[model samples]
Target: MRQPQQERSRTTRRRLVDAAVECLAERGWNGTTVAVIAERAGVSRGAAQHHFPTREDLVAAAVEYLGEEQISELRARAAALPDGPSRAEPVAEMLLDLYTGPMFRAALHLWVAASTDENLRAVLVPLEARVGREAHRVAVELLGADEARPGVRETVQATLDLARGLGLANLLTDDTRRRRQITRQWARILEPAVATRTVRESA
Candidate 1:
């Protein structure tokens, strides 16, 4: 039926994106090509091109797709909260996931490539900005306490930045618990910073 055909098309497109993500993560950004994605997806280059006309098009979509996939996981983590202060635990946990998760690993790989490739930066910069802003928004929406502070955004973003750094450190050293502990400590400390800033702002 027409619906089945449409579903097949959608699945193929999703497969291409999944293939691209695996290729990028496993092979690194520069190592991945449209041909490689096609091969990984079990599709012809022409079929891949039909879905994504240019190399950059596929790269950008892969980045956005990976981000969306990760955010979905984060949303589920957020939703699992118990509807009270206890919810902050999962929020901190989600932040941990964004930093150390597979999707972030792929994203960081793309970022490393984008740093030197101006053309790639053109494709990736917007995505990075969106991800950063969205991460901050998620922290505020899900984790921020009452009497929200003016500098809460900074605290949350800083926590993310530190987690990212520590994540790479953990990647090289295979030290997951160390980085997780750092994030947990920062999450506890950030609340007071927010309260202090809120008091100052309210005065």
Candidate 2:
């Protein structure tokens, strides 16, 4: 059981993580450090060390923070729309939302740092798989795909591939119409897989 001190420690750790996220957003991964995060969180260096023994561990946690943040936002967007077809709407609209803003950029920056860290890669890779798999699962359920179907792997892979490629394109370019075009195109491609019922319900 966590005592009062331990509970406080946990709170402090959360603050540190939040602060580290801000620092990463503000300074990028190379500029973010234990001392900087501790200062940002209003906790001492010792408290920071107590939570994260190394800067690498801290960076790893920041990547996790980014993933959780993105997933939560995506899921919220998922829930706000209708149940079925509306499900496809979020998928249809992902490019616009994902490519915009500081939060995602910060997360991407941390990801680049985490990708190069072998120790962090172990944790990070699974997180990537989970997000991808979860999105694919959503697509499958919405599409009304019969799991026993032989072509299921190819179907799911298509959604993942288009989403990844379209997202990168959206990020690189400033053309909003082009971004919308890609999403709509992907949505059309996704229609057979997730199903019009899900899209209809969502719409």
Candidate 3:
């Protein structure tokens, strides 16, 4: 049901998007040019431009691409959690893993660059909002947090905020020891608040 040309185009676009994400993660926004992406993707500059006319367009598309990938990864990780009262800590650890990885690094590059570039901001703001919403939804679902409960949503968001802060620390320094310590401590604190039966019973 698909034409050869259309399939080829899709493949090329995927390669370009993947290459752009790698560049953003490793080189930062200032160094991730179309030429470099094209080379990394093994596509001609013309082909890359044909797919993404501007750098902003390419970066925006890459962000969306990476967001979808991260969401899929989150869903898979959440699905792997066993049904039990003790799922909170493992889920929290998984969430922290998601926040501190390469995808997060690529996103940080975008956030930093977008802070100063209006054109990039125009593309990043809505994408960032959507990613945040999805992350919140996945975290709440995985932790079995009842959003309708008075403070449950805030508690879940606070966990994400803490993980994000630790991830920011990871960007500049080796915060592995602190990250583990905080995750364990926070998981203990969140255990009662995010208990599956407790939240469901409250709801």
Candidate 4:
């Protein structure tokens, strides 16, 4: 009885979090009300309230849940890439895919909302920091970037920043062509740095 109850609780919470993400993506912060999220989740208002006592609490939990899901998906995608000298482009492409998708859009909505809402900022800042750190770790590991080498860490960070900027552009304009051009160009630059580090370490 206890086990089943716990499982059901988890299911309900998951549905609520997922519904919150969808709400955030479809409607901006002001539009994503607790009642709306409950409707989308197919749960009663009381149940939503029981799960999340306040709007801030619910949105914070939703962001954390989405961040975890994104990180897990990132790791899985990274693990699927073929290991070789030619892995950099595919890794970079995978990173771009992660940055340009629905989860990123949901996060962008939160970022814009948090700019004016102190409560939201208080919840988002630390969560964003954690997600950024984990993303950097995954990128460096999957791309076999040698941070011990001079400027390698900075290069990897810059690549991520560049990708994010491109993704932001994608939100407003059709930057797909430019994004591809820039990604390929950066991949060319990054591959050499990775190769130099490998040779130096092997020598």
Candidate 5:
């Protein structure tokens, strides 16, 4: 039936995208290719090309697809956060977890490639911008950050930037022990920095 054929087609496309992301994370952009991804996905080269005519197209789709998956995971985790005065530490840890993962690794590879390839940049710039905006919005919700408060927006953005730096550090070596310590300290600092005070004060 048409329904079964459509479902199978969707499955194959998902496999290709997932394989592309995994390949990007493992083997930098120079190493990832349509043939390799097709092999990893257990699909034929022609099938992969049928879905994504070019390597750039495949990688672009992979980044957008996984970015959404990560965002959805972030939102789901935010809903389950424990209610208490000390939620910042957990939130900080969770946010850091976002950057130090396979998706981030894959995206980093794409970033490096895009830096030199105008064609890749043309495809990636807008995708990353949209992902960045969604990430910022979700971070505000998770941190209970009041953007109206002075420095609060910067504080929230700083947390994400720190997480990214930590993720970059992790790409070279194991930075877990130190990363945990840093995020813990940042959480303590962030709790007050992003606090929404009722009484207005002069800046």
Candidate 6:
């Protein structure tokens, strides 16, 4: 039996997306090109171009693909969170882990590149906004945050901002111990702020 042409094309596209992310993470934007991604994907440059005519097209597709994957994983992790007072620490850790992964590194490269390139920024800005909104929504759910309460929403957003900052710090060096310590402290501070009782009782 042989695979259908549609399935084959899908596989090729998946490979190209994966390879593009890997290239971005490993080589940054300058070193990542259509030809490099094509070679890494094990497809001809012509085939790669056939699927994504421009580098921006491929990068946009990859960001969109990675964003969905991150959101799906976030939902799964949120479901598995333990039911107890200790949940905040794990929730903090989970959200921080989101930014420390390969996808974030790949996205960071694009962010720096997009800072200077108007065309790339045009392609990336909307995609990044969508991803950021989804991330914030999931963080709210995971934290059991009651946005109806004052400051609760900002607290959740701060956690995400902290995670992103830590992720950027990790790009230059391994600061795992310090990062973990900071998240633990933030979790302590965060738990009381977002806890259901605190939200209801706070005046």
Best by lDDT: 6
**Once model 1 is optimally superposed onto the true structure by TM-score, how far is the C-alpha of residue 109 displaced, in angstroms?**
2.3
Query: What TM value does model 5 have?
Result: 0.92
Question: Each candidate: RMSD to true structure?
Answer: 3.9, 3.9, 2.3, 2.2, 3.5, 3.1
TM-score of each: 0.85, 0.72, 0.91, 0.90, 0.92, 0.91
Question: Which 10-residue span in candidate 6 carries the lowest summed lDDT?
Answer: 194-203
- Model 1 misses residue 99 by how many Å? 2.4
Minimal lDDT window, size 10, model 2: 95-104
Instruction: Encode model 5's per-residue lDDT on 1-203: one tens digit a residue.
Output: 99999999999999999999999999999999999999999999999999999999999999898888888988898788654436778888899877888889999999999999999999999988998888899988887777987889988888888888989999988889999889888878877776443112211
Model 4 over residues 1-203: C-alpha lDDT tens digits? 99999999999999999898889888978888889999999999999999999777787788788777877887887787666556777777777656676667778898999999998899889988987898888878877888888988998888788778877888866777877777787778888776454444545
Off by over 4 Å in 2: 1-7, 83-87, 99-103, 114-123, 138-147, 150-153, 170-175, 196-203
What does candidate 6 score on TM?
Answer: 0.91
Q: How far is candidate 3 from the true structure (C-alpha RMSD, Å)?
A: 2.3
Candidate 5: worst 10 consecutive residues by lDDT?
194-203
lDDT of 5 at 1: 100
Which window of ten consecutive residues has the lowest lDDT sum in model 3? 194-203
* Comparison by TM-score, 3 against 5, better one: 5
Strongest candidate by TM-score: 5
Winner by lDDT between candidate 2 and candidate 1: 1
List candidate 4 stretches off by more than 4 Å.
195-203
Q: What clash pairs does model 5 have? A: none
Our tally of clashes for model 6 stands at 0
